[model samples]
Target: MIEAVSLTKRYGNTVAVDNLSFSVKPGKVTGFLGPNGAGKSTTMRMALGLDNPTSGQIRIDGKIYQDLKYPLRKVGALVDPRWVHPNRSARAHLAWMARSNRIQAKRIDEVLDAVGLTAVAGKRVGGFSLGMSQRLGIASALLGDPEILMFDEPVNGLDPEGILWIRNLMHRLADEGRTVFVSSHLLSEMALTASELVVIGRGKLISQSTTDEFVARASDDAVRVRSPHLQRLRGALTDAGATVHEVDDAIIVSGMDSANIGETAAAHNVVLHELSPQQGSLEQAFMQITGDSVQYHSDLDEAPGQVLASGTN
Candidate 1:
């Protein structure tokens, strides 16, 4: 397991990570989520001892990373996929890493096969596509047969098939009783792939919970209604204390499920041309949770208004 306790990091006046604390358990996938410049990479770097923290500490199995007798054998990471020699073949790259770490040379072929790079292992890395390079990076990280693996933006450049492959690979690793800690900006993918999440904003911890709990807190499955008889529906819904909102030329009744919305519409003698549940997307939930810590803001203030029966744009 990996534990981060009150971890903080600062570079001059900029606080990259602020008292962030979380743990990544074995045999599961924990997603690290944040916007650009939100310090996801910085937190990861500190965890690996690539950078020192301003205060606090992190440990892999209750020991400082720097003190690990066989660090590579305990933890493997792919922070930067660009840290590769273009001239080297995929097999040669992992072989060099193994040699440096005193790892047996035979394991190089094992990782190459594990990452599905055995076919291209002899090809020069410079000839690889972005997806191939990413696979090569994964192969390099697994060269030591580490139990804990950390991937930073693993799907940054890939086709749909490649993304699916990586997603399955993460789950496969966890199924093998290995710990998989990954960071990604893809909310939809994360929603489907991650078992748990550690959400942060502007270097501060915003949330740490399982995917189901996070969704429960943010997802509001409300039925949206649209009709020419907006006033009547508004009045009836407001009388019934159902939350409503005004769209372009329609009324949206929320706070109730589809069945209740339909029943209310029929009871109030209201006509509706369109009535569909406004299933909140993961992106909306993410935005709502981290709104205050957003580093970039737009001039237009389009805050989603909430109300009972009627709301203005």
Candidate 2:
């Protein structure tokens, strides 16, 4: 497991991470989520000992990263896919890393094949496409077959197929009792890929829980009801202590489930055309939770004409 206790980082007057603490357990994928400049990268950097924390500590298992005998063999990370020698071939790059860490040279071929970069193993990294570069980075990270993996924006330049492949690979790693901690801006993909989530904003910890529990906490159990007798149904629902609102000719009932709404309508002799529960999506839940913490806010007050004029300018 990876654990952080009172973890904090400061760059002069600015605090990049503030009193953050969380644990990432093995046998499951934990998603690291936050808006831009929310200290996620800084936290990950501290975890790998790339940057020192201003106070507090982060540990892998029971020891700090520097205490490990062979750090790469215990933890593998792909923080920046582009952090490679431009002229070196994919194979050469991994070979050097494996050599420095005293890893077996044969393991290079295994990881290259695992990441689907075997065919381009000899190609210079400078000439590789973004997707290929990502694969190469992943290959290097897996060179030691580490028990813990950390990936930052792993799907940044991946195509749909590449994205799906990485998602499955993370799951497969966790299934083998490995710790998978990844950060991504793609909430939809995170929703499907991550079993647990650690959310932060403005350098402070906001939430850390199972994905389902976090989403459920922020979602409202609303029921959508549409009926020819809209007036009667609305009155009956409101009388039953449910909040009702009309939108696009449909009544949305909150604080009540679909079954209760349907039963109430039936007893009141109100005919319903539709009655369905509307569950909040992960994106919606994230937005609601992190709404106030967003550092950059876009101006939505501009008129269409103003937007067009500004674009031309």
Residue-level lDDT tens digits of model 2 in 64-142: 8989988889999998898999999999999999988899999999999898988888988999888888998898778
The residue pairs that clash in candidate 2, if any, are none
For each candidate in turn, the TM-score is: 0.84, 0.92
How far residue 265's Cα lies from its native spot in candidate 1, in Å, is 5.5
Q: Poorest 10 consecutive residues of model 1 by lDDT?
A: 304-313
| Candidate achieving the largest lDDT | 2
The per-prediction CA RMSD against the true structure, in angstroms, equals 6.7, 3.4
Root mean square deviation (Cα) for candidate 1 = 6.7
**lDDT value for candidate 1?**
0.85
Tens digit of per-residue lDDT, candidate 1, span 1-313 = 8889999999999898999898999899999988667889998898899999999998888988899887888889998887888898888888878887788989988888877888888889988988888888888778888999999999988899889988999999999999899999899999888998899988989998988778768877667788777798788888887888887876666677778777878998888888887667667888878878777554434555533322111
Q: In angstroms, how far off is 240's CA in candidate 2? A: 4.3
Could you tell me the TM-score of candidate 1?
A: 0.84
lDDT of each: 0.85, 0.91
**How much lDDT does candidate 2 score?**
0.91
